[model samples]
Target: MLWVEKYRPKKLEDVVISKKLLDDILKWAREWDSHRKPLLLAGPPGTGKTSLALALASSLGWGTVELNASDQRSWPVISRIVGEGVFNETLSDEGEFLSSLEGKRKVIILDEVDNLHKKEDAGGEGALLKIIRKKPLQPMILIANDLFALSRDLRNHCKVVNFRRVDYRSIVKVLQRICKLEGIRAEKDALVLIAKNSAGDLRAAINDLQAAAEGKKKLTVEDVATTIRTQQTDIFKVIQKVFKSFDPEVYSMAMLLDETPDNIIWWVSENLPLEYEGDDLLKASLV
Candidate 1:
């Protein structure tokens, strides 16, 4: 369990980079109101959008409800819960508290809001548009790799915060700290290589570390070479589809092709313009 969830950031501060953004986030958390529009955290994966949202809820002692795109957002589900209840609600025998009385305001985190591509009875973009406009009881945070993919109407209703890719140096510091905690010895060069190779994704670096650390308690360059396998080229071909193709199926398959999320992103970044330009590129860049 420790190995699997070990890399999950325990606090907002633990998330690499975006310190100023985190400070502003904490301020919004202090007073969560219906007037507070849903905030879209836009950045590359492993940069800590989801982690920061969860950590904020944890620090405030509030309960967090997470929604994913895979879940059915049909009308019955939305009306009975998420829609009728204000960013969704937690029911207790005491009564339905508008905000999670778990000592802090409840936080509703919607992951992959950009996935609102298809039409659904639960109102889809239409329902969300209403929800955001109203500014529900509990605070809501939406995490998306692509902000431009969001519906123009929905985008207009919410506050969008931009998150940049974390620097290699920042990721190295995080890796070093984790090494210290795990009681593992690591050379500076090895750590730097892992950080650089991870392509600014902290999660990938941790995964690499875990894989390398498996054989030996101490990590070195040799371990990294043997443990973390390089991504295949076909992965890049599919990622090219994500930006260049307008077909929905293309987007769906592109995310889960034979490559890891981090590797796929490299292709997406590299070839996004090969298929698109201007606003499309801007929108793709947001994701």
Candidate 2:
């Protein structure tokens, strides 16, 4: 639990490799108008969607209200949180007479908005569509794992920005920072292994590193070998074995290969023209 959220980035600059998008988001914040359209952040998990939203709110010195996809995302919630009600709210200063610096513009972050499946009964998507189409009193941002899953109305109304998988080097730097914070000495090889296994997910890599580092002050390749696991790349090997073998059970061998059917099909498609000709090519195609 301690390491789970400890390593999370608190600002855009700390988010490893999202400089361009961060710049664009900040620019939009600076150029805020009454009609500023909602911004949609689309990406896979562990890529700092929540972190970026919070960081942006902080940067602008604005009050932030967050809601996840599972919450009541209907028009009522949106209106109460960011619509006319927010604009009408005011707070009195304490007896100290300290002046408040709170800005009128608030940042409302909606997480996993893609999970708000279209409901014919509730018209949840309809409400969101109208909100996005019309200008809001406060700036709103939507976070979703899959942008394609969003409704056409919501998709077109908002400015979409994609968050891609973290690269190997960036993941490494993040892991190193965690190691330093935790006072754990981890080998470069171990860090690289965790990063590679994470497949470009910094959160997953950090979790794996923390899990592997448990009960030890030092982390090594042996620790990673015993703790962290990765999807096998044995599919290619199995394919090669089937191609080289003359056994009548070649079909069975193909089946035994570590590849998923999708991968097997891709491998066959990739090298068919280069390696097979005539009837053999036709047979491969049929396979």
Candidate 3:
């Protein structure tokens, strides 16, 4: 099995996220009301948005009703979900019936909401807007890779929470734990390199470690370097996309670079003049 799936965080506390952020999510879930806006968890991919959503549901002893990109983009499904209760699993995390006490409380996770493109999902945006504008029937957490990609009206209707990219240090800590669990004798520097290569993507770092250390009890920096060099992509293309692509795609493209997230800013600064000029140049530089 892939290490990413094997080591996935199953509880909110286990998730490597800020305590205040976790508290905010817990507070919303505990105080759920019909008038409360759904939580919009927005950030770059692989930042534990979906994992945190699932973990939150698990920690609260509530069942989860998750809608993926396909189901979420369908108007018929979205309409039905808001209009009626579709989930049949009403058991709590402890295997006890929860409906009697919590009144059928369950979290509704709408994943990849920012991917709701026009024409492809003609009525999805309108239907979602209507659902948010009206009284929210349940606790909902919407996950999006790019917050700005979503419509302004949708953003206005929900409580938008921004998640920053997971720092490499935090990622390295998780990687170290994984190495210990797997009984792999990995050099700390190799793990650090893997973490930096991932550019704040914990999942990617885990995958890299797994690939580099597979079928071996001892791992070295040379082993990881060889694998990374083979898998490395052209940084030029990433730079091009970063400057030329849409705002929503900029972060996604930047993640493709082999450089660390902190170093990406330097690359952007160096290439800013090559892409934009005059007021646009000054504005982008400020950002």
Instruction: Write one digit per residue (lDDT tens) for candidate 1, span 1-287.
Output: 44527667777667665667877787677655534777778877767788888888888876776777535544444444456556534543232544344434556688877766445346476667766676676667888877787777777776677787779899889888888888899987888888888777777777777767765668888777655444334465566555556777875776555345546666667776777789977987887
Top candidate when judged by lDDT against the true structure: 3
lDDT of 2 at 131: 56
**Ranking 1 against 2 by TM-score, winner:** 1
Candidate 3 ranges beyond 4 A from true positions: 70-75, 85-103, 118-123, 233-287
Q: Estimate the overall C-alpha local distance difference test score of candidate 1.
A: 0.69
For each candidate in the order shown, give its overall lDDT on alpha carbons: 0.69, 0.70, 0.75
Ten contiguous residues minimizing lDDT sum, candidate 2: 90-99
Clashes of 2: 0
Error at 179, model 2, angstroms: 0.3
Show pairs that collide, candidate 3. Answer: none
Q: Give one digit per residue, the lDDT tens place, for model 3 in 100-186.
A: 456556777888788675432335666676666665556778898778988888898887888888899999899888889999988
10 residues in a row with least lDDT, candidate 3? 86-95
